[model samples]
Target chain A: MAILNLKKIGVSGVNSALHKIVENSEKDFEIRNPQGQHSIACGINAPLNVEIKGHVGFYCGGMNKYAKILIHGHAGVGVGENMMSGYIHVKGDTSESAGATAHGGFLVIEGNASSRCGISMKGVDIVVGGSVGHMSGFMAQSGNLVICGDAKDALGDSIYEANIFVRGEVSELGADCIEKEVRPEHSAKISKLLKSSGINANPTDFRRYGSARQLYNFDVDNFESY
Target chain B: MSEDIPKTHPRKSATFDDYTLSEIRRAAATGIYDIRGGGAKRSVPGLDDLLFLGASLSRYPLEGYREYCGTDIVLGSRFATNPLKLKIPITIAGMSFGSLSAQAKEALGRGASIAGTSTTTGDGGMTKEEREQSEILIYQYLPSRYGMNPDDLRKADAIEIVVGQGAKPGGGGMLLGQKISDRVAEMRNLPKGIDQRSACRHPDWTGPDDLEIKIHELREISDWKKPIFIKIGGARPYYDTALSVKAGADVIVIDGMQGGTAATQEVFIENVGQPTLACIRPAVKALQELGMHRKVQLIVSGGIRNGADVAKAIALGADAVSIGTAALVALGDNNPELEDEYKKLGTTAGAFDDWHEGLDPAGISTQDPDLSKRLDPVTAGRKLSNYLKVMTMELQTIARACGKSHVLNLEPEDLVALTVEAAAIAQVPLCGTDWIPGKKNEILLS
Candidate 1:
């Protein structure tokens, strides 16, 4: 597999190189020292393994399909944004807006992630091992947000159609972000997800949160003047 | 101590509203006339005065107001097209709550819906009021992605990727630090009192190459069903339109400099952009060269005043026209009743545009409680609807006068340009001429 030294190219030229890697490389490829820049690995539908080292800018693994991307360092805003179907792992700290609006994928951030981690997330399974920032899953429509560590603030503001489980302190819950009963239906699934993500945390320590469906159909009676 | 350079010296004195003194002050401040945004601010010939040359031997004029004037349209007929079916060509332009007050935006949506068109939400997150009132909501995907969600994207009738706006072409948004209320702040995930600085370039895209991927990401996020539109400020629009089409945009929304905003630097407003008059022709030219002219429905905005202007814009190759300033006016902004308030603000009626101050007397311009109360959504919405209907009728009258059954049927042959800029860009003929460059087709204007 080819090693793409990202410092050698500008942001615009990176896509072609990644596309070439997807076409040419059979095994996982390695990219080194990528400073914060946009669109590191976009629209790759192949079932390939890609590792990006160093801080990455927005949309690192966006529109990803079938490929598995691993970022070794910190990530900028909107990392793994809008990923269709893939696996994205951020080993270090992440900036605000990680995993924004991803349709279907598994996003795992090992360290702390800033606010709006799973904003408008769709059909993705996000697992944050460390503490998560404020508004972690603001307006999340579907999918799941699992925080093993402390959740800073507004854990799930204006959330709808999403399953959320937080293991630690939630500074504040967002509007319409309500707690739901964690019945026997979710026990097996939660435990399996925690173990697979390499986190041996107790499933019983987590509490589930989701939408109240209050703002779905806006009416004078239902609308809250916001 | 009375020093040599006194505080009240001639140099420090007011020149009594003297034109020359003000001119000197302006000249000292800047070398040229200061302006901003992307529309024509200079006085150039417009479609208002242009009398169409109806069909003589080959073409004929339809009875004015009697014959049908078809204005129906569907965008994204090209490679990357929106899947929406529109009954009318006119659609509401995206205006943010941070720009225009909450009420004004609601009124625009009301008007658009009444006219069987679509309304769009801007940089701010979707307001429940807008979603409830608007029949078809075109949710905007801005760089900030404020309040963006997969559910909203899927729920929207269409999605517009706003790369830039006409008001501050290539410049980031600045809704002054003062306007950020608790709600606005909460909506944007910003500090309550901090200046809202938007990144001019989207974080997801570094250039056209990345834009392609971003579009794909959006398509993936939305499950590839909703129509996706790429909006650009009218700067280098010829290439912007073509490249956007290449980058997988189903529809291209081209906004010219004349488009209004709630708040922009005064310097940027008057000086930065080509007039809407100049933007249309080049965009159409680029579309024609790519052979995607009418295929990619072009929606043009900026300085659209009367129905005649709308008709001209469409004849010049726009599928429809979107208005911001006009729509606001229809809702009683600058109304004579607010003259007292205008006087208090050091301006007069019809001249007070304190849109920056958020003290809108007509609720259509401000989020203030007393001011917002002045604007009854239902009544104001109806007025806006009436205005839109009148504009459409005027356009129909013009189309019929040009002997065309449909607004789109009014060809370029019906127009004549008085200036070279107008001629070259608008594709209209020189005044008193059957002679158009490469006039290989029917000559009706002669």
Candidate 2:
């Protein structure tokens, strides 16, 4: 484990430093900075734990796998994009498109997330404790998006294999996003995620959303007008 | 607005058909044809009664409405390793407003949203009205490539790269000058009424190898949060479907002949492509051979009209089905109230003249102000919803009779073809036994 203090490092220094650490270091590391900057900890393969104390910019921990990323402050747009597998935790608010298109992994955001969070997610689990912006989880295939607070408009449009759970008011669901009962598997998963996210566990409060499995592809009979 | 302007003069009182033909002529040059989207110019076998051969001893019908007719389909299973999980199997096909009235396009969005399915955008950029009305909006990134913005991309539920359409296979989309409004022109970044020419190939890449990279780039641009669909006209669909999978498409949309368009060359509409029935089996064969069927999720469109057509398409191995012409009919296109207008055009209600010109009496196809105004979006959408219900009912009945819980389970094993073309394309035995080509599927996959 290596400790990298950010009292003296700004965006440029931190970006350069993290790039170097990513190149040279291969284990768990602590990055001490509290400011938000773009492209923090992008594309790292080796298993590592990256701890960021402050806010970050677009694409923080993007396309990363085999690593555990913990952000103490808020995050910018497109946080944890296309992640293959790993764990990411954000303590504060996140900008648009949080945990977008992640195939496999766990992305836990303790605060509100902006629009399009978990868009096209394949097999990832995105847990947002607060409200999310519009068009969240659009066209997602396989994955789980859990919003502790409310979900904005167009919740799940033309979705495939993904499942969504929102606890608070749903501004409006997209083309799809029907309410489904929380089953035992879902209860167990939510219970564990609540524990990992450091929140009080109450799995029953959340409403599950998944494909009515109606519009998986295209069918003529379903399209009456056609 | 004058309830009866000189627009309908006895001497100049033209039928909706006449206006469209003249408009098309004005939009055309010496030999060049005007273009757009919509349905058939010539009559062919449409989605009326390609009746199903229901089961007997091993099958029993379920109660129609009470029966659980599951239409669930999974997309992007094989190629992307990740696909869009849609709730229903019915989806709206792509239709652009640059070639149509704004009201017409909005109605499409509203209708699709009401039905709990997805609506697709045309070649132009994402419209705010569409975004607002559409529950699941699939944005198209076309060869012409208008309105390709990252903000909309991120917001989109999925991205469809439209290669070509069924009515005009290997041909690009066209918006005649008469239909081009100021707002439509601005949004498309092209001059109004200048005969818009779309890109023949994608601006992003040259070949299939490059297409793979472009797909990745699109994922990166959206932060990997949108399902990417590759749509192609039913020309060499077996190869196209196989290659699109290789290029990493989550879903494959294969459009066949009889698919509608706003405007296309009359020649292209009549010629240039295989029938919808012929095209579907080849595409399905490709996916099944590669073990990508049901995994990659194949959507087949063209000439789809009724519940029987829908059931037949599913039985042929399509994960889903799309419609254009049937949608128009449901929206009140062939209404008998427009009978007088049709007489003036030398046609009738069910036989309305043409779709290319911007002068539809029902206000479904044209861009003309008065013509389009005739269609009230609210009323039109309600009709569309009703129409959609009928289709669902038809399919449910078929699904029940077939002894299947879901319409999607109505497989080829339950069907037999009446024609050699139908049997060959459908891959079922020639009306009696099971004698499909094993090498045919392998060839398509290869």
Candidate 3:
């Protein structure tokens, strides 16, 4: 395993070193002293294990693909943004817009997530251990967001086909987002996702939320809803 | 004798014409408003209202045959380690891949590369073909963050954060379902066959202070190599320019109301933002006041048609000009040859603005595979390059006539406005008069 110390090399130097490593498709990486710097490990394409020991700033692991990134400390806004076909594990809390606009990825936030979590998410599967702030999964088109803890107000506003599974106390749903029956098939999927995320929660404990389907097709009779 | 005279009925009011009546009727018939491409259709003060004062006696003109007038400009020299050095002072404005066919994007790239200038990867991120074709590609960071990826950000020669556009300052852009091809849908991370509306504001940052940080972050991401440009719609030019300068922009792009878009509400297009003619002077003033004039390059866009417009913009203290609508026209959009097809679509050639419909005959604006195949990128690219060459030569001719050694040396003193409104906005003297309305008192006091 190669160890990258941010304090010694600086942000650009470390990032460049990581980028070169990814380009070469090398071994696992251990990053130290991230020191809340932004864009840590961004644009990494090759399959590798990247472990950051300390806190990171915004856009950490952004545009990640075919890599596994594990952040030991808290992350700032837009963590794992626009990631495609990767796995990101944030050990601590994350700021707003976590996993935003990500198409394909598995993001696991071990701690709480701020507002707009999974906002505009396309196909990423996000599992948050702690509570999520308001407006989580706003305009989510695809994928699944499994929140282990309580959800704040206005959750899943203007959501599309994406599924939301919340375990704790309910908050108000946003426009077009409504509670749905958690069938056996959904519970099975939740169980698999929980296992993949390494969460111990029972799948049956959660409730599912999704688009009301009233907006799937526009009708002049439903004009006011628009 | 009376029968021999042709009977003439009361003429329709020029102010409330056929098109106006049609628009009203259409609006009433359909609850939703019209969304289309192109800029303001209304006539306003533009570069056409300005003319250069050629040198005769007081100023000596350069011999057109022997003398050389330079047009080279270096952008993003303020803070960027690697700046873009262009042979001409014109760059292609951002047009998204989703809004325009891939062939059109490639054509834009080819033309800009041939002309030794830069092209932009507009809203929907950068396509691989566009990246490979464009010599110097500027990546536009828009509000939606659609298709924005770190790889493309690193690949760009420069990055432009689009705060607003001239056609619709505060309005978001729309990509109708028809234009959202499979590739476009994948790039934008949206479902296929669904209407997509980009956000009006960025999700992360709110205002100027946040914008400053965002710019810093981008610089770090690109290793401080690429120049960062702040593009704003021409609303409050002075304030926006000043704020952009303060936000650490290496370059500023002010787009006027005449700037075209892929699709936006007609109301926003025709009734929003200031004209290009009224945008340049105030922006220049802001730069000058901040002691950053020429240090941070200014690229003005919107309704820039010919070489005269380019010269006029440069004379008014703009370092460069960007073209969008004109560029599309150069690439054979709304060509006269496609007039019959356009008529079938219920519009004429030169008036074709319904780009969101995905039924373009010229194939430049649509996502339909059959329609897009109509445009041969190679031929269209050559045409664009030829147009660019003509404009460059025209700019040189004007510069030579004005006795300027370099295009950048052309100043406001060499221009006179034909209209009072233009004279006031451009701060140039009206024809046959020594007065610019707002500046006369300042000149007298000075």
Candidate 4:
């Protein structure tokens, strides 16, 4: 393990340091004095474990691939955006569009997430420990979004094949999204996801939601829903 | 008695034309707005409305074949460590694999590589064949992010952040169920045989301020190697161009309403964006105002057809021009030979635009395996390369006649408009008169 201080090398030098670490086949790294700098530790292709000491700004760990990034403090907008095949664990709350449009990854947020969380999420499995704000999972395509706490308005609006499991109450369901019965397989899946995300909650307590399939094909009768 | 009285001539109303009546009937029958492909069919002020004034007494013309007129250009030289170097100023525009067949995409790549130019990937992510065939491939990061991945981003020579397109400026993308094959479905992470509607706005970023950050993230991701281009429709070229430059773009691509699409509402295509002729000047003006005209290159598209259109676009201060519809035409799309098959589809050879239905006889815009097999990549690529060569030669010929050594040296002063609308829109003087419709008033006020 090696430690790189942002205060010494500056934010611009982070990429070169990451490249050097990857070239050397280094497995672990610790970044100190992050100070909410944007795009920190982003676009990492190699598989490595990285720990950020302080808060990070927008697009932290964006477009990540085959890496594990752990942020100790709060994250700004678009954290873990468009990530593919990686793991991002945010210990504190995150701003808007968490795990947005990610193709394949696992994002675990220990605290609450703001509006538009998992917006247009493709195949990323996201588990948020606390509540999520309005319009969360808007136009979500595929994946599993697990919310242990309450959800704000318009949850999973215009959703696609993605499954949403919420342990707490949902204020309202968006158009075309409906609650579903959680079967034994769904409980097992939820339980496995919770175990992976380090969340200790009863899988049966969560209720599943998904697309109603009514708005799959555009029809004259579904004009009102659109 | 009837002959002597003179038969009353049957009159037809100009307001309700034949085409208009047919369209009305179509709307009443289908209940859904007509969704099709290709560009605007309506006539507008285009490159044809402007003509170049060849050198006479005051200027010396370059010898046609003796003196060399350069057409080579470097795009995204502002920031990218490696910019695209092209033999000609004409490049192929973005057309997705799902919208076009895999064979078509391969043909585009092979043709572009032969012409020493670049081909782009569209809303659909980069295909394996497209990447392998194209020497210089520009990857489009669209709102859908369908097949977007970090590995593909690194593989691309350039990155184009799509804000809007000319065919449907503020609208999203639609691929009907007929086109979504197993391959397309797997790539987009959607079920097969479902109507996929791409988002109009990007999921993460919203405004220009956020766009700047987004650009920075991409730059960081790619290690600042690839040129970043911001593509916008011709709705508000001036503001969009300026804002793209401000957002740290290495290049800007402006597409006009005449630009082609795979599938979109006909009403949105014909009614929405500005003409290619009307879009160039404002975008150029914006770049000039920012003092980044040549520094941040501009690639204009929409209705560019031949070398004349390419030369005209360059004369209007564009660095390069892209072609979509014309390229398809060169690849045997809308061929007169396919007229009978087209008639079976209820359209003519040159009039077939229902690309969304996936019943294309020409095999250029379809996903059906049997239809897609009609196109041979090698033969079609050869034809496209030949067409690209002809267009380049034509541009060079025009540049020589205008007494310019390079295609980039062809200026607006060398062009005159044949129509008042063209003079006003292109800001060029009308032929035989020093009067430019709008500039004359500005000159008088000054």
Best by TM-score: 4
Candidate 2 Cα errors over 4 Å, as ranges: A1-226, B1-37, B40-50, B76-87, B343-347, B432-446
Q: Model 4: how large is the Cα RMSD against the reference?
A: 2.0
Tens digits of per-residue lDDT, candidate 2, A1-226, equal 6666655764445434444444555576777764565666765555778898788767787766677999989987768876778899999999887876666788999989988888767577888988898888876667788889998898986565588888899988877468788899998888888887786647889988876655432344456411
> Number of clashes in every candidate structure?
19, 43, 0, 0
Cα-based TM-score, every candidate: 0.67, 0.61, 0.92, 0.98
Can you list each candidate's DockQ?
0.06, 0.02, 0.37, 0.79
Using DockQ as the yardstick, the better of models 1 and 3 is: 3
lDDT of 1 by residue, A35-154 (tens): 876667765656778898888876788767788999989887778887778799998888777787676788889898887788767567888888888877876767888998988778
True contacts kept of each: 0.05, 0.00, 0.22, 0.71
TM-score of 1: 0.67
Candidate 4 lDDT, A1-226, residue by residue in tens: 8888988887667866775553657779899999998999999888889999999999999998888999999999999999998899999999999999998889999999999999999999999999999989988999999999999999999899999999999999998899999999889989999999998899989999999988777787676887
First chain of model 3: TM-score?
Answer: 0.95
Docking class of predicted structure 1: incorrect
Residues B188-276 of candidate 3 have per-residue lDDT tens digits of: 77778777778787766678976886776677667789999999998999999999999999999999999999999898999989999
Name the runs in model 3 displaced over 4 angstroms. A1-9, A22-33, A45-50, A181-185, A213-222, B1-17, B442-446
Order of all candidates by DockQ, from best down to worst?
Answer: 4, 3, 1, 2
In the range B1-446, model 2's lDDT, one tens digit per residue, is: 87666575366444657756776676553333444345455655433324466767677877777868886666655544345555566678888776556677778778877776788888767888778878788889876555554557667888888877888878776666666678776765444554454545553245677577556656654545577898888788889988988888888898887888777766687788767777777888888898888778788898777767878888888888887777778778878988998787666888663665666788877768888888777777777767666776777788888889988788887776565555566666544444454423322211
Measured with C-alpha atoms, the lDDT of residue A128 in candidate 4 is 97
